[model samples]
Target: MIAAPVTPAIATLNTGSSSLKFRIFARDSLDLLMSGKVTGIGTDCRMNAKVTGTGAQIAQELPGADQEAALAAVIACIDAHDDDWRIDAFAHRIVHGGATFTAPVIVTPEVMAELQTLCPLAPLHQPYNLAGIAASGRLAPDAQDIACFDTAFHAGHSEVVHSFALPQAMRDAGVRRYGFHGISYEWIARMLAEQRPDLAAGRVVAAHLGNGASLCALRGGRSLDTTMGMSALDGLPMGSRSGALDAGAVTYMMRRFGLDADALDHMLYEDSGLKGLSGLTNDVATLVASDDPRAAFALDCFTYRVAQYVGAMAVAMGGIDAVVFTGGIGENAPGLRGAVLDRIGFLGPVESLVIPANEERMMAIHARELLETRLELMP
Candidate 1:
């Protein structure tokens, strides 16, 4: 009798501004072997992980507390746990792919150049993602680096959905709505297709609520419209991002406060949203726990924006058949979810469920698909 071949291990990395999350999975079955994150980089960076089935936990303090250091810690942990396991490929969650790269691609020098042009579009994220890719390449030279873009899943939206009221020349230059948080949405769509065909076939609104949040309207499992437009900063307010501000308002701030582009970017991307509004931390758990009135106000504004966008997404879908809540806050913050749902109760009779964000698994699936396709073409 012939024995079946064993698929190699695949690793997915989702790099954030101050953290890096990763998971290792069995390539053939996509069964998660272990998952963890390194958080608080630049301060007290700590790494934590647990094996999927056995719940074997691992923790460490990464001295340098940077992406490179965090990655090294992860590798060391994996090696210590299972030296026999071979890491076949490393997949990444790239924030933006611009108007091109509508699918996942293996990272090449030319691909890196094209992706660099898109960094300004997702200033807070794209650079770190590319950096992670580079880090992976250096650490594991033999493993293939596959970039699965957050913008790729929404690439199929109609021009009308992606376009702004910009001039023809600007639109020609790729200035358009390229949604973020797509990997999370794609995971939700896949889960729905497998678990609830009825809802999957109908109009659905998915709210990916986290430190970075967005809402996507889906029709038959494809993005029809999304609250986020052109940039990640254009959707609902997030932990520190000022979402959906008018262009004129930005220019006014530039003129009045003598703020340049960089300063303006910092204010919008780092100083605003929950932190700015609450005069406290951007963490939802912290805000929820606080007795400060500003905390309540911040929570109110976040929920209000979510509810507002939910209505808009519903309109975009013609009608919403189901509403999905996912991402860190969406899955874990039941009170926040209830608050948003309460405000948009009229949109009901719409089924709702909290789906945990699984972008790592989704990226792994993309990596497998791309690798398999490459193998087929190698002949």
Candidate 2:
């Protein structure tokens, strides 16, 4: 039997619509011990996991699976290696905290219920996020579960930034800008503040260009405003989401095209964006490699939208000081980044840098903070 390390560990779970990503980290130093992802959850599912330091890996098919089953598999895989390893805290990346939660909080039955109410705001992500939490509770009944909201980092935005040009009743009913990609933005702010203090102190536009893409304007480690408003689907074109479609178009689809609400939802959330534009795969690498003119058009649209949002982000912060890209596409696709920057170069001599997404680490950090706060309050 392998002996567990002296330090406690944190299991961070990040669940998307069709995937569950997990990482275990040493609590004291925050070093990664293991990382894995389970993909195709609702279909021909598969899981691929590996021990971080060692080359040991686990790969298998997960037939007819869901997030709960996939999460259980992850726990089993971790325990198989080191049965004694203590997962002291379970941190989750919850996509929506709505207007109530401003920071990470210890999960309770009441809190979970409150979270369920906000699921309609983030239908694609919130329910799965809660499922991961519930699965963790069942798997490790004694562990402390913490929810680090993706919207928490943007909670400090001024009322003007969050306001919609609607009636006061609508604004009061939580119909206002609540930016997404905030966990990624929070991580970027912390990284920039540590690595490039000057840029971090000034106005900076950080673009998190992933499958679900958004841009944020940060100044002195705070979000001024962001491209995404009220929902995740209101920003730059994403891998599948139709970002920022006009309200009239949606109504036209319903009345003129006879599309029902469910069909429209599926079209906006599942069949749009780059995939719809290119009529091909949503994978950026594949799109970049393709000879298809449609692929080129999709890429061009993505870049142009990003550049346009950067201008808006700059306006939100009064001016641009630096531009940071960090996401699956932002960190890896230099061509996309260059295309965006070329159009927005007039906003420079703006510094440009690519930082990898670390929302998992950011969640772990929030979890640790909430834990410390609880400990300090203990008698």
For this target, which candidate reaches the highest lDDT against the unseen true structure?
2
On TM-score, the candidate that comes out on top is 2
lDDT of 2 at 210: 87
- Locate the minimum summed-lDDT window of 10 residues in model 1: 1-10
Q: For candidate 2, which ten residues in a row score worst on lDDT? A: 1-10
Clashing pairs in 1: 177-230
Per-residue C-alpha lDDT of model 1 across residues 215-278, encoded as one tens digit per residue: 9998899998888888888889999999999889999999999999899989998999899999
lDDT scores in order = 0.89, 0.90
Backbone atom clashes (below 3 Å) for every candidate: 1, 0
* RMSD of each predicted structure: 2.5, 1.7
**TM-score list, all predictions:** 0.93, 0.96
Candidate 2 residue 239 Cα shift, in angstroms, is 1.1
